[model samples]
Target: MENGSDIDLLVARRLQALRTRSGMTLNALAERTGLSAPYLSRLEKGERQPSVGTLLQLARVYGVSVGELVEGRPGGDYHLLRAADATAHQGRDGRYTVLSGPRAAVSVMRVELPPGSRSEEARHAGEEWLHVLSGRAGFVLDGEPVVLEEGDAVHFDSGRPHSLANEGDGTVTVLIVSTAAPTPASHPMPPASREATPVTAARRPAARDR
Candidate 1:
C-alpha cells in the first residue's frame, strides 16, 4: 500500500521519464502545459507536489490519462486506491482528487469547494456528471444557475461554460465524472488567447442565481 509521499515520488519519476521519452525540455513542457518552467522543474525534481489539474494539462499535452501519469503504465485491473494514497490538488478552483484508474475512459474526482471558494469557470470538450455527496452545491452552466442538495446529481455537456461553488457555510463535496478527449502534443504550446489560470489567488466572489 503506497502512502501519499510514495505516490508523489512515483508521479515525479513518471513525469521525468515521460518528458524525457517525449524529448521535451522543462521550458518546452512549460509552454505546452501552460505552467511555469521553474514550477515544472520543481515538480520533476520532487521539490513540489502536482495538482490534479496540472496533471490533467500535462496529460492532454502528452495524450495520456492521469492514471497513466500516476501509475506509470497503461494496463492493470484491481487497483486498490486508498484515500491516503490519493493526491488532492488545491487551486483557485476547488480541491480535486482523481479517483479513476489508468485505463478508465472517464475521470472520477472528489471535489471539495470551501465555503468561500469556487471552481474556475471551464469550457472544454466531453461530458460532465456530478453528484452532491454532502453540503449544498451551486452550479452555473452557460450563465444559467442550478442548485443541488445532498444526494442530488446533474449531467451536462461540458462544452458549456460552467463553474461550481459551495452554497452554504459548510464545504461542498461532490463526485464528478468527466470525459475529456486527449490532444497529443506535436510541438511547443501555441499562444493562448487568454490565461488559463487566474493570476490573482484571491477567491472569487461566489455568484449565485438571483
Candidate 2:
C-alpha cells in the first residue's frame, strides 16, 4: 500500500490538475479557498500536506466531493474487473472487495460482515442497491428496520440515515452497488456534525494503516 507521503503527492498532483483543468491560477484558487497562493504552490509541488479542512475547501471550490477531487481519474471508454485479482479491504468491522472497474458508471463491492458486526448510522448523496449473497443482514433505513436473507435485495436512497448489522450466525456477504460516485461526504458529511470521521462497513479504508 502507498504511504501517507505518497498519497499527499498524489493529491497534490490532482489539485494541480483540477486547477489547470478549470483554468484557474494559484492566486485565483487561493482567493476561493481562503488559502495563500504560496501555500497552494507548495502544496502543488508536494512540499506541504493539507489538512482535511483544506481538502474540503478545495473540494467545495471545485464543485466535487473531497473523494472525487482526491481520486479523480481521466474518463475512459472501457474497464474490467477480475475476481481472482481483487484486493479485499479489511477493517475492524469487516471486509469488502470492489467489483467495479475504474470506468464503470456505477460503483460496486462485495461486502462481508461477521456475526454481531454492526455499522454506524450514516448518510450520503446517492442511491444504493444491495443483494444478499449469503447469510442474513439487518438494515435500518431512515429509522426503519429491514431484514434480508440470502437471495434478497433492497434498494434505497442513501441520503437517508442508515446502518447495517450481521443478523445471522454465519458471515454475511452482500453485493452493493451505488448509482453515484462514492464520496467522503457521503457518510458523516457536510451540514452534519464532524466530531468523528465518516465510516461505513463496506466503504474505503482510512488513508493510513492502523
Give the per-residue lDDT digits (tens) of candidate 1, residues 1-210.
Answer: 666667667778888998999898888887776678999988887788665456656776776776777666456775668877776755345666768877535667787888977676665445668788899888877676777777777787665566888989998998887775466675443332332322211121352233
Candidate 1 — which pairs collide?
A: none
Each model's TM-score? 0.65, 0.55
- Top-TM-score candidate index: 1
lDDT of each: 0.69, 0.63
TM-score of 2: 0.55
Candidate 2: worst-modelled 10 consecutive residues by lDDT: 201-210
- For model 1 the TM-score comes to 0.65
Candidate 2 structure quality by residue, lDDT tens digits, 86-153: 65544334666556655433666677888898865645445668788898799877667767767777
Task: Score residue 203 of candidate 2 by CA lDDT.
Answer: 22
